[model samples]
Target: MVKDQGLSIVHVCQSMDLVDSVVRRWIKQHEAELEGQPGIGKPLTAEQQRIRQLEAENRQLRADNDPIKKSLGLLCARTEMTYRLIHQLQQKAVPVQQACRVLAVSRAGYYQHRRRGERKADVVASVQLKAAFVASGKSYGSRRLCRALQAQGVIIGRYRVRRLMREAAVRPVWKRKFIHTTDSRHALPVADNVLDRQFDVAAPNRAWVSDITYVRTRQGWLYLAAVMDLFSRKVVGWAMAPTMPAELVASALCMALQQRQPPRGLLLHSDRGSQYASLGYQALLEQHGIVCSMSRKGNCWDNAVMERFFLNLKMERVWQRDYANHGEAQRDIADYIVSFYNCTRLHSTLGYLPPAAYEQKMAAILPIGVSENT
Candidate 1:
């Protein structure tokens, strides 16, 4: 209007109630449009405005299609699977809100699904922990229980196992103090300390340690004599009777002889009790060509390995039960030795393997039919 009607630019600004700079900018934009040149800021031409609108729509369309392409087959999958995909996409720098929206899932629902899965996993872990504790006869502490759970394919740590044990209100049996009574002041012949505190034997049947412990039952005291092969710390033989007599120890030695049939020169060490020093027991040792080694007078540490076995027996099994009779105690003790102790218990000395398993594994790796000394 200023160019064709001879109206001044200032007059046009006043008529339109606009500032002078605004009118000047509009005129410059119109001149750029007539010359087919692009101008900055808001486009004054119709074609440029339509082009800007289409560019914005194209950007919005690409943003909407990107998540859809990433979640193609996932849309037909289960809701749980969809949530898992959403989680995976979020980890790969995809926005969770956008992914959930494209997959037709509510953001709150996806979060709730994740929480439910976590709770389920916790429940399964608790159940497995409880089962392992019970299977150990409530005798395993956190270290052993952690190993047990790992063996069962449960990935857990010792601290976590301890926490679970506390939550479940489960605990291992505690050991009690007991006195040792040995009749060592007898006039019977005593052998020298030939074994000499060498508890670690390189092969089975190379060395054996024997000891006797007393168990209380309703039928009075029951004495148990056990023979252990020092190599694997296994109870090779054991005998139980109402009295702690020479015959009881003899029977135990005989059982060990029949089972192992070791070569001559096998060393058998024991405390200098009357039963171990009895004429019959010494003669049996001589007849079998076994070497008899006696511990120092009143020194139990000489037979520390056997002493430890007895301690474990008392603490883990005998002390936990009120035995009604000798037979019951005998059966329970046998089960602990044969089924649990020898077959399943984790021995720290044996690299956390059971006695039987340790022996088997060594047999496979070591030479066949050759003694440790050989």
Candidate 2:
């Protein structure tokens, strides 16, 4: 009556038996509501009342749909993962039947999964599978994981291991492509491809391949030079420096020489990077009575073993880290080479034996007077 009929506030107050101040306040509130402003008290206009009713309906709809949205997201996950989630919900005072309905999973299936998890053998297998995966630095897939379980007398197959991995939500870290760091365009003299891709060697120290790769750090790039024995695919020697100078590679070579002390005529191979071709490096090779072989220009396959080693290094260790400084990266990489790669990591090429283990096993079997080559 106050807004549409434009009745005077005093007249309306007298007619409705309301106080004059209350009628004036209500008139102001009604005018504010006409302009789409909501007040705390009852809505006086039809449009304002309709707006309030819609808001209440919207709130109720959102409340009704929230559980459904959450359940839809959970249902979209893997079936085993969904079952695990439902079990977790059940532990939190949520009814199993309700959780199953919300997750769109059959109650019978959820119960079955829980029973399988409770079995002694299944539980043991799951634990062993996870333990083996972690022991491989989370790097082993189903094939190697199965072999590792068998080595421990677990009697698990590859397919079963894969299934358990899914149930346990275990997965290996993925590998990124290897980046080439070789700069062979310098005018320095590069040795011929004398090693000639003969990556297999009958005796340790008979042939070795070396390569350089860079690691990123907060401070700067750290260059790593490594020498691997082709006989065992072992990282015999490695050195890290803030810069990739000729001395960096020389230090790695010196370590290899000091460690192995191979006989004269040992063959060492590397890319034609200028550091490897430096006169000082060549002099060190000559002084040690070692033959220096270089990969052909633009061909990484000539030093393929070294390339593969770098790839494995980055994929399995270096790429997975975010180094804060040179020293940290150096130490971590050294640990990987000594503690993991040489000591524990399985190499398919060596019949799944680690390089160090393979070397030891071969040494124990070799005849005392006969050479590995013979």
List candidate 1 stretches off by more than 4 Å: 9-29, 37-62, 65-118, 175-177, 189-197, 368-374
Worst 10 residues of 1 by lDDT: 365-374
lDDT of 2 by residue, 279-350 (tens): 999999999888999988988789888877777777778878889999999999999999999999989899
Clashes of 2: 0
- Candidate 1, residues 272-311, lDDT tens digits: the string is 9999999999999999989999999988899999999998
Return the TM-score for each candidate structure: 0.76, 0.66
Q: When superposed on Cα atoms, how far off is each prediction in RMSD?
A: 5.4, 20.5
Off by over 4 Å in 2: 1-120, 175-180, 370-374
- Candidate 2: pairs in clash: none
